[model samples]
Target: MVAAIASVASVAARRIRGGEGVATRGRVLLTLDPGALSHLARGRDVVLVTGTNGKTTTAHLLAAALGTLGPVAHNASGANMSDGAVAALATRRHAPRAVLEVDELHLARVADAVSPAVVVLLNLTRDQLDRGSEVAAVATSIRKSLRRHPRTLVVANRDDPVVVATVEGMPRVTWVAASAGWSGDASLCLRCGRQLVAKHEWSCPCGLSQPQADWELDGAAVRGAGVTTPLHLRLPGRFNLGNALAAMAAAHALGVPPGAAADAMADLESVAHRYATVRHGSHELHLLLAKNPAGWAETLPLLKDYPALLLVINAREADGRDTSWLWDVPFEQLPPRPTVASGDRAADVGLRLSYAAVGHQTVDDPLAGLELLPPGEVVAVANYTAFADLWRRLAVMSGR
Candidate 1:
């Protein structure tokens, strides 16, 4: 009854705000109360997408790819949980379908509420150990959620041993494997309890000869669909290609036209702080988001090649203050050590670099490093919390 009341109240609030009648208000109502999800899709379909690391980016891209079919609702601002899901449905009025990028920990909770017509599981990696169960625990939670609702279309990443191994007994799954350099195998076989060996180049079982998608991302271009459009991806690195593939494959699973997939990629966008470029008094800082070992490891090559000053911020627990992950991250790979470190945990950042024997300076905020940095080129790597802190400080410093 409480859920129903929230639905009704949300609709009424939308109407009071001059919303677009029941259609728009209805989406809002359904969000506040997920029984409305069933009601809204009574005769329609919904798509639910989830993953660690790239959920927001991949979810939005898939939604945009399928948007050509009709109006598509998604968490454009990356509010990808139950509350954010409620917030997303609250505002939108019309869409043929909703493509939601949901949180890994909250996937089951929100999935039960929204009960998406299709469920997408991207690669599961380590992140937010405080707010979430360990990756293995969260993967089990996802399996349990799927068991409750059997009709949802399942898209599973085959390259991730932990993610793929969870759903082995289940036959109703579309398998997706990325043949790129991201090859990760953190978990072993559920049935054999043995670490499966990769064949066909560290991809399949026990080095057995098998067929797999040979995915080589040329810039933003993906092979294997005879689909080669001009690569217009805003983000760099090979990891993004997998995110792009997840979007493309998930869009295909939704029955969206193939052309729309490429078109959406052509018109892609980015959320704030995911490689967002900021200009402060003739200085350009590409705010790159690096939160975990995988993400941090991926950044090393990019940072090494980038011809600019390195600025990093690691403040909150979310940034993994232990910073021991840096040991595995190969910090010495970058040619020059970071020039400045700032945040509540700036010392932690400096210590990690120092341990790796990377050089650095300490500052109170991003712009403080600016006083010592040359104004021509610079890069700022901020974790989840530090990003916001740095953003506000930069905003004030820039008078924006």
Candidate 2:
């Protein structure tokens, strides 16, 4: 009965897309089975990317790269849940492969229904406290899923100890190392259960025998697909480069030819609002959804050499009830102070920024906070809910 309903929903959704060019059948199915993605795949090349951060970006890269080789199915919109997976999968006809990004904690549910050719665990970080297990616990869940699928090749970030530790000795898995040491930090050593120390801007090693990786991404600009543009991404920071490389390696592992995969990344489109740059009068606003500590840390480089205001919003229960991790951020790096504080929980965001020497001007609503921002160059770091509320205002203000 479950299969029948899902197939029917997907068929009707496909028909609607032909005329309307928009599919809602997948949205409708979300109510029936949030974990229904597992059922839709059989004898198709499947690439699954699971992690706390950068899954959306990596998935988009993989989708773009795979499109050149053959038809590909991808949840590029970042919905990422079962319904979203069905929607993406339903749009294609006779596609050879599908690249899907699964939420870290939900890997077990999704993996149960679908078999994958390669499973790429990007990196496990502390995120969504109310909903997920600790990094180690979540890594364990992913391990169980990997253990269940014996043939699936595991592609991963060797720099991340948690994921590297999970499938260390697992055979038929390819590990890829990325040159993201400059801006990102993976604190714990997955091998010895000790804090892996980093020396002279190199690897975070416990000096123990760890598994070797298969591919490596080195340098600021990437060289693949016969293109070497340096990839000075419109999106700021170095950690994102790691996300880009993970997709490149995964797509290659799934057999998308290296040259074409790089072309897809170079000709990539923004994932709706993920790291989308919008211009106001004089200031440029980069919109991103930071939901956890690692998510928030990924954007720290955004504050480099900017005297503009900083806004941090923390309200969702999934974001964690305690915002004490704000102190953990190296806010001392930001020299100047912010202009105002705003969000559903403006007080909390203000307090965090305030401790870092930013002033507090409360606007109970995120939309109202936009009014407080002077009509010049501005930077805003909003939570998912706050971004949803103020996205319209941001579009209008930045002339999106």
Candidate 3:
């Protein structure tokens, strides 16, 4: 009765709060029934995608790929903790399959409960330093969880040393040669604690090395299991291409044909507006979310072509309180363009840029910063809460 009431109330709240009640629903369920998530997840084919970055997009892709087989329940709004999974599963109890994005630190708990048929580990990086665990600690947590759930098949990135180390000897692991765009986090060897050497493949003097991949991501295609399919996606960035490869490999493990899965993913334009563009006074404002340094490393290069750039930073609980990670970003690599920093921590962002010798303006208000950009095309990059703020502001501006 409590489960039913919570689900119904959550649906009602979603309508009133513009679809922001998923976490609330999950919280209510867990509060009233401690085992609500595991109970709701029973008898469902589940795939849990967890990592420091690309969890949202990879979960979206995996959900889309599985949709080709049957109805899939997914946390499309990016609420990725155990509570969020409970909300998604409870609301769609009849769905045969579920693709959930799990938080890095919560993967062990969620995986132990859900016992997902497949788990995709993207890459581990330094993020949310104020409250989150360090890279090695996060990897150790996942390693222990996978040992507990021996039946789960893991699809891991071979290029990322941390990811490779996490699923090293798992019997049913499928390694994908996904690009490790940021290697700063994996400089030290996980096995020998010695410095790793990265050339064609990352290796340690103690004999730890990148494993042979069952599925390889070639430029625009994924080749594996005697098939190659081109991923024609509306999402931008090479990191997304690697994400697609991971999704395809996991889908194949679930018995879905690679071609059909790729076809299903092509229509997905964006994941919670990661690369979504909104109209602003006769100009196009492209929005991208970059929370940590690794994400910024991949996102910065993609913005080289944009005529104007706006960066928003915030230190809310959702976005780790310590803004020191901003210094790790490769702002020096940013191309010459009209740039502006806006958000609660816009001053911090501006200071970092100043040290990088990139001239920029600081505006505490995001919408006001948008107004300052010259009309043509503006690329906006923001962290967690800042992105949500700008997304809401754009919706209100358009009277949505």
Relative to the true structure, how large is the alpha-carbon lDDT of every model? 0.64, 0.67, 0.88
Candidate 3 has an lDDT of: 0.88
Ten-residue stretch with the least lDDT total in model 3? 11-20
Q: Weakest 10 consecutive residues, lDDT, candidate 2? A: 15-24
The order by descending TM-score is 3, 2, 1
Q: Which candidate number would show the highest lDDT if scored against the true structure?
A: 3
Give candidate 1's whole-model lDDT: 0.64
Ranking by lDDT: 3, 2, 1
Which residues of candidate 3, in runs, are more than 4 Å off? Answer: 1-3, 6-8, 15-19
- Residue-level lDDT for 191 in candidate 1: 35
lDDT of 2: 0.67
Off by over 4 Å in 1: 1-44, 179-187, 190-192, 199-232, 315-323, 392-400
TM-score for all predictions? 0.81, 0.82, 0.97
Best by TM-score: 3
Tens-digit lDDT track for model 2 on 1-400? Answer: 4566667776767655221222367766656766555555766888888887788888887888788887898876665666566666665635779988887776876677778888888887776555647777887888888889888888877766677777766777776675433233356665567666556332344564334656555476554434453443434557667777777778877776666667678766466475666775555665666666676676777656554553646567545666665666665566565466676667776677677775557777654555566666566777665665466666766665
